[model samples]
Every structure is written in C-alpha cells, then in structure tokens.
Target: MAWYHTYFKGLPQRAWKLNQDEEYTDYEVDFLRDVLEITPDSKVLDVLAGYGRHAVPLATDGTALTCIDISQEYCEELQTTAGRGQLPIEVVCADVLNYALPAGQFDAAYCFGNSFSFFPRTEMQQFISQIASALKPGAHAAIHTENLAESILPNFQARNWMPVQDDIIYLAENEYRAEGGYIEAEQTFISGSEKVTHHVRQHIYTLGELTYMFEQAGLLVVGTFSNLEADPFQLGDEQLYLVARKQ
Candidate 1:
C-alpha cells in the first residue's frame, strides 16, 4: 500500500517544499516547544517527525532530538538538513507501529498533529507503548488531536485556505463521517495547472476513550484540555490536547 509512502516518504517535500501546515507552522512550532518544555539539556523523541520540521527547530534551540518517521524520504531530508547544520538529529525511517524504541532515557516525548490516528486501535495501543518505552520514569508525553466530539457527530465542516504556490492558493473544505470514529473527506486543490482532489480518513476518539487508552497503556492521564493553552475541555472545542506521564 502507498499509505506509508504517501504519508511519510513523500511528506518532507510536500510539507517544507510545498508548505504543508503540519510540518511548518509557527503556532504548532510554539505549541511543541511548550509541550516539550524544552531545555538546553532536554533529550526529546518525536515520533512521526516529518521533514524535520519539529526536530530541526528543536535541535537548533539546543534540545537533542531523535526523530522517528515512517518514510526514508523524510529521514533522508532530515539527515541532509542536519548535515547542513551543526546539530545532530537522530532520524529513523521505520513504521511508527513497528519502529523499535531507541535504547536511552529521554526527558520528554510527543506525537503532534494527530499522528496517532493514522493507525487503527490495535496499532494505536502499540504506538503508545513505544512512546512510553522511550521515556524515563515521570517523563512527560503530549499528544494533540482534533476535537473528538466533533468526530462523533461528523457535523463539523469548514473551508480553509492553503498556500499551494507563492501566489496561488487551494480552497479546502473538510468534513467528517461521525459514525464510530470513522472520518472521511476530500480536499480539492485549485491551481493554474490542474484541479486536484485529496482523499482523507482518520478515526477520532472521544475524551473518555482517549484517556482509557492511555491508562490502559500504563500511562497516567494527568490532564486533558482543548487547546495548547491547557484550557479545560468543553464540548464544541476545536481541539483535544492530552498530556500524560508513564506510571
């Protein structure tokens, strides 16, 4: 299947070169910084670190990073970028569901931009375990996902602008099918050359289920919120940000 290639192998160029928001964004950049609570001595692991978007910046800011991705293309891009710089970023190209945990204690770990939902529940459990294995006791873990309730009803829809080119843009309308964590939609991109449609699907989990999964994985759900600001979660919130620590 092209799932790995489409999502990981091809991500770096599309993200950095094409300006995809998941890889390059000030808001998220700031958010992960806050999530890591980065320190000069922090050793961080970013699962599904694509295009080195988070790793490069985090490494620049002085946090030693080990970035794991499913795509060799992204790993190569990250390595090349690191070679062009002074910092050493550990980049691994392996399936997140199957990547072996690095053998070292880490200060913090994270999976941002809703990277976990790419797998079904069976894989999600193992993904959580792999993340926990990377951490020392009491190390913090943060996961950011789109609001869960919104996915339950699939009543949410929005049109947003994405920069497809220097002067061109793509108008994207996103929707979800609320039935049992199934979310599917389309993104139609309009530019001078062609009109392209991108199909998307993700399973959304509610707060209860999210916490339940974390606890099942032997991680304590210390807090849950709707925004990176750590605001209390409320229905209709735009996002679901969860924070935890290994038990």
Candidate 2:
C-alpha cells in the first residue's frame, strides 16, 4: 500500500483540517466557479476529494457533485454530512486508478489539495487522460500542486517542523531524489505521549512537461495561477493552481 493510504488517519488529518479553514475553502470554491464557469445545474467531479471540503460547499448551492476518494473514513464522513443536509453529493470510496469514469458525463472536474503529486509519470498520464475523457468538450478542469520542480527546487528544505496545536508538533525530513523525479519524505507527528510517522513520496514535474501531458491527453492548458485569487503563477511560487479545458 502507498504511504498516503495510512498517512492521513491520525495527526496528519488533524493538521490538514487545521490548515485549511472554511474561509480558504470558500475562496477556492469561488475560484473554481469562475474558472470552470459552474452553474447550479452543472455536474462536477471531485477527484481525491478529501472529506468534501470543497464538494460540500459547492453542492450546497445546488450543483451536483460526484466525489471519489481512497479514504473510507473521509467518504463516510462526507456521506453523512451530505445525508444530513440532503445535498446532491455521491461519495465513492475507491482508488481513482481502478474506478471507471463515465465519458463526457461532467461539465467540470478538479483535483484539489495538492493531490496531483500523488502519482508518478505513467499513472499521472493515465489519470489526466481519464479526467479529460470524463469531461464534455469545452468543459474545464483544475489541478492544484505544490510539488512543481520550479516551486520546490528553489525552496528546498532538508528538515522542517511546525506546531499543529498546543501539543502536537509535525516534522518532515525530505530528500529530493533527482533520479526518480520525486521527494522521499519521512514525516512524524509528535503529540504529548504519542508519536506517529509515515514515509511518503511525491512526484514532481516541470510546467512545460505538464503542458505537454495535458496536450497529449486532449486537454488544453488555459491558465496557471499562483493562488485562488487568479494571480499569475511565477517560477518560484509556493503553489500552483492550473486550469485546463477539454478539447
């Protein structure tokens, strides 16, 4: 099993929830609405949708949503949340690679939360192609990632630690494996009397390479932003939010 399968269960999940606030989610949802030109009648697909942070808010306004995630915990939570509100959200607990996406069924799609870096070259290509196939012509798709070669190479850190809460400290030891085009990280979360650790890997790609991949997948790269505010993506930007249109 991949490290991410078990990485988000304990301390990391808590930290993720802590970092992404409701305000931030609203801002991102607004960006998605603008970029994808979403309407209340639109059908959207959320790949690797963790706990429905974006899906819930988008669905609340009447947009139909189909969210796929590997974590059963997250899927169940999202299902319960949607059920309670009677929202139009279909939660699928399955890996993206194995799941079959219906062709031309969606008006838009997005993979948020930096989950684009989860796959290496081949798998990444397959996923991108699948997303392209899933969207109608002229429909849009967004991908967010902080693992771009230009983004991380300039601000590479060997070790870093941050306090998630009053008691929990999250530390990361990262090694950039140039040969593999990925970063191997040993992350640990230390809370009072307990410590949880995970070994994770994130694949990195250059912007030009990603553009070519999108082209090959029958998608056109329309724009790249540094943030949800629609700022142009610079070389050393810490984050990347890309918008593509299916051809």
Candidate 3:
C-alpha cells in the first residue's frame, strides 16, 4: 500500500469528525456554490472527497456529485450515507492523480483541504490538467490549499501542536527546502494513549508558478482569494483559494 494510504487510514475516524463540523462544512459548501456558480442541475466533481464533507452537502442541495477518494473506507462510508439519504452522489475510490474522468462531463470541480500540493511540480501540473480535462469548456474549478508564501515568511514555525478534538491533538514538524520548492512534514496525531505519525512531502508553488501551471492546463485564472470567504489575497496570507475556468 502507498504511504499516504497508511497515513490517511489512521486519520479517518477522528479527522473526519473534526473536518465535518457543521459550521465549517456549511461555509465550504456556500463558498463552492458561489465560486462554482452551482445550481440544482449542475454536475460537480469532488476530488479527494475524503468522507464526503463537501459531497454530501452539495448532493443534498440537488447537484449531481461524483466523489473520488483514495480511501475505500471513506468511499464506502460516503456511499452508505448517500444511499441512506437518497442523495445524488456517486462515490469512487481511486488515486486522484491517475483516476479516469469522463471528459467535459462536469460543470464544476474542486479539491479542497490543501490537497493540491500532494505531488511534485510535474505531477501537480498533470493533476491540474486532468481536472481541466474533466470539466466542460468554461466550467469553473476552485482549489484550496496552504499558501506557499507562508513557508517563506519569517514567522513560519518549524514545529507546532494544536488540539483537533476533545482528546485529540495534532503535532506537525516542517522542513522547507527553498531550492527545491518543497516542504517535508512529519505529522503526529495524539489521542490519549494512542499516537500516529505520517510523513508527507509537498511541492510549494508561488502564485505566479501556480498561475503558469493552470494556464498550461488550459485553466485560466479568474480570481484568487485568501480563503473560501472571498477575502482579498495579500502578502503573508496563510491560505490560497484560487478560482479558474476551463478554456
């Protein structure tokens, strides 16, 4: 199994619960609805859907949703929930980088929760291209992730810990290699007597770099925000929420 599979496998139960907080999910759904201009007749794609935090709500709003994730457990859970709710959601378990998507099939698509930087630069470009290919011409694509600018900031922390839930804490140690434009992180989740660790390397891209990649993928940038709330992006922002349209 892939390293990420093991990493994410240990996270689903607690991570899903924390991420599926009602307020956060509602904000995300509203953000996507506005940015993607979603409607009841829209066909949407949620890559790296996890436990369907965004998918369920989007489907419940009457949009047709296709959710793809690497975790079979997450996919199964999402499938069961969609079935129980009789929502228009289709769940698929597959690696987003290589997953096959029907060309021009979607009206909008998104990858949230910092899932954009999972691969190296070349592979990341391919991932963007694949997303563009999956959407109809003029369809919007929204991507949310940590801003690379944060890594270059002087106040960047090499190690940090934060409470994720009642008894769970998340600890992260980061190493940024400027020359390679990548950040390697070791993350630990501590819950009572149990602890789990995972290592991940993410290619960090400047706004200009990301814009070039999106252009190469036939996705033209339309807007860039600091977050899902439509705040203007400025220097020192920690998160980037970019919107583009397939050409």
lDDT of each: 0.71, 0.92, 0.84
TM-score of 3: 0.93
| Candidate 2 structure quality by residue, lDDT tens digits, 48-161 | 999999999999999999999988788889999999999999999988899999999999999999898988899999999999999999999999999899899998999999
User: Runs in model 1 with CA error above 4 Å?
Assistant: 2-4, 8-35, 151-155, 158-180
Better of 1 and 2 by lDDT: 2
Predicted candidate 3 versus true structure: per-residue lDDT over 101-204, tens digit per residue: 99999999999877777777888898899999999999999998874655345467789988876878888899988888877889888888998888877677
Instruction: Say what the RMSD of model 1 is.
Output: 3.5
- List, residue by residue over 1-247, the lDDT tens digit for candidate 1: 4243464422223533575555335666677677657687889998888777767877887789888887677788889998889776888887766667874488888887566567666777777887887788788888877647553344565666667557445565666654556556565555566555656666677778778888887789887777656788777777777889887
Ten contiguous residues minimizing lDDT sum, candidate 1: 7-16
Candidate 1 local accuracy as lDDT?
A: 0.71
lDDT of 1 at 142: 84
After superposition, candidate 3 runs with Cα above 4 Å error: 11-13, 150-154
Which residue pairs does candidate 1 place in steric collision? none
Question: What is candidate 2's TM-score against the reference?
Answer: 0.98
Better of 2 and 3 by TM-score: 2
TM-scores for the candidates: 0.81, 0.98, 0.93
**Residue 220 displacement in candidate 3 (angstroms):** 0.6
What is the alpha-carbon lDDT for the whole of candidate 2?
0.92
